[model samples]
Target chain A: MSDKIDNISVGKKANVFFDGKCVSHSVFFPDGSRKTVGVIMPGAALTFNVGAPELMEITAGECQVRIAGEPDFKTYAAGSSFKVAENGSFEIHAKDEVNYICSFGSD
Target chain B: MSDKIDNISVGKKANVFFDGKCVSHSVFFPDGSRKTVGVIMPGAALTFNVGAPELMEITAGECQVRIAGEPDFKTYAAGSSFKVAENGSFEIHAKDEVNYICSFGSD
Candidate 1:
């Protein structure tokens, strides 16, 4: 995977959630696509509600993730990814400080 | 000030600091310059060491900042900015969740 996303527009401000347990910035692609680059604090277990289908690509660290309706929590590590359907939610527990890029709108 | 930075590249990974109290994403400019978009958690009082002189521009929220060699703390709010010399440090206490862009290099 590319280390950086080029020629895109990014919001100057950040999107803070979970009282700062999760922090992310919004990146806008020229093709009208949007993504978020984020970091989750270690040992923080949080549930994220998805508005669209999302592909969560781990760039660093590891996490245990359980998508809504899934029976088991799966471990996702660096270079790994998981998908959540639109209108769904997922619970994530960061095994370490997890860095991830979240792509929305599709599986 | 511009709400979004266009035509730049952003790192997929986040830079987490202070036990995840501070998180930022690197933005690379075509001019070979770099900046970071970041958020500081509310009630967090932290010090950041500077490698190069930096301009810290507030994007949202508010904070009180005391740059090294300065005797007093000054409050900075949205659209405001401060400069810190290289090899120096600054203490910042967020009044709320603070969103800022730190542009490195001389003022």
Candidate 2:
């Protein structure tokens, strides 16, 4: 929920996904920490596979997320964060353009 | 320099900078490409040291940049891109809150 970050480097090359539904860039910190800042355009639902644990925070707009096995989807908006376990998968639905930051953890 | 990037995962932590002058998150692609997307606030100019070559693109607002020994600073607006040599330094001046995506290259 913090609005400030510092002391990191970025990666070269753009990462495109879902036929252009999402786009993001990588960020690296001095202590080896990393995260991705991106925007998701309004459209259909998206399913994502998690390799490592992740913390997804919505910076703008709103969306609903359904974690695997969850009975109901939870809605999130700007300043909200949700966690996804390693090897877990989640489905996201956004009605409007969504800007977010996904932070991967060591697990 | 592209507006849309996809298929990338993000890191787990936020990268903070310059005593709250900037903040960013990391993004990772399935193919290992990485980048950092961030925002720089308006204030005093700041100098940065580069470990690798960097391509800085302004996504919102505008800023002035001085790459190392450049005689004068250059202004960049949204959709504009600039390059910084590996191991080189650069200075940035944002008149207002400036949103940017910086891509790091392996020289």
Candidate 3:
């Protein structure tokens, strides 16, 4: 792949994918795709349930993630890196509106 | 691997790596490593020479990259993603102080 950075723009669509939120945004693999932005509003959370996942740095605000049977939520801030297991389940919550990018593949 | 982002800090060191700048910062692979910050200063450029390279988003300022005898430089701003070939040589230049992160592996 070219070493050039790819620029992507997300317009004014305040998009959020919640538990069971499976919307195809970009075709990452022949049989899989990714989401541009996943938001967790005040008192909101999401449980992801499939695919090989990769997350970009949290660009703004903060959020909490609970993975597997983890007791406490792991907090993350902007400019932080995150990844997800292919068949794992995790919940994400935010005190305010938070936005992030996620990519997935089915290999 | 855990989906949590690994936190790293570069304490008080204004580090820059130029062509032939090979410094091991983090051990990514058993036999390979990565560099945390690569700065290309005003009127300065770098040519990366080895490894499986993955760059984090440009975090500050701006820079230009020339690859494979390409005529013009690819300008990248903060939050842009970039990757590098395992054995390819490319040149980078900046008009001002620019900083970025690069990760590499032996695989």
Q: For residue B22, what is the lDDT in candidate 3?
A: 19
lDDT tens readout by residue for model 2, B58-83: 88778999999789999998888888
- By DockQ rank, best first, the candidates go 1, 2, 3
Query: Quality of candidate 2's docking, in CAPRI categories?
Result: incorrect
**Root-mean-square deviation (CA) per prediction:** 1.1, 12.2, 15.3
In order, the Cα lDDT scores of the candidates are: 0.93, 0.73, 0.47
**lDDT of candidate 3 over B9-75, digit per residue (tens):** 1211112233212111221222334344433445566666645545544656688877644687898
Alpha carbon deviation, residue A105, candidate 2 (Å): 1.7
Cα lDDT tens digits for candidate 1, A1-107: 78998999999889999988899999999999999999999999999999889999999999999999999999999999999999999999999999998999864
lDDT of 2 at A95: 70
DockQ each candidate and list the results. Answer: 0.87, 0.05, 0.01
* Top lDDT model: 1
The iRMS of model 3 comes to 18.2
lDDT score at residue A76, model 1, on the 0-100 scale: 96
**TM-score for each of the candidates:** 0.96, 0.51, 0.36
How does residue A30 of candidate 3 score in lDDT? Answer: 25
Which stretches in model 1 have alpha-carbon errors above 4 Å? Answer: none
Cα-lDDT of candidate 1: 0.93
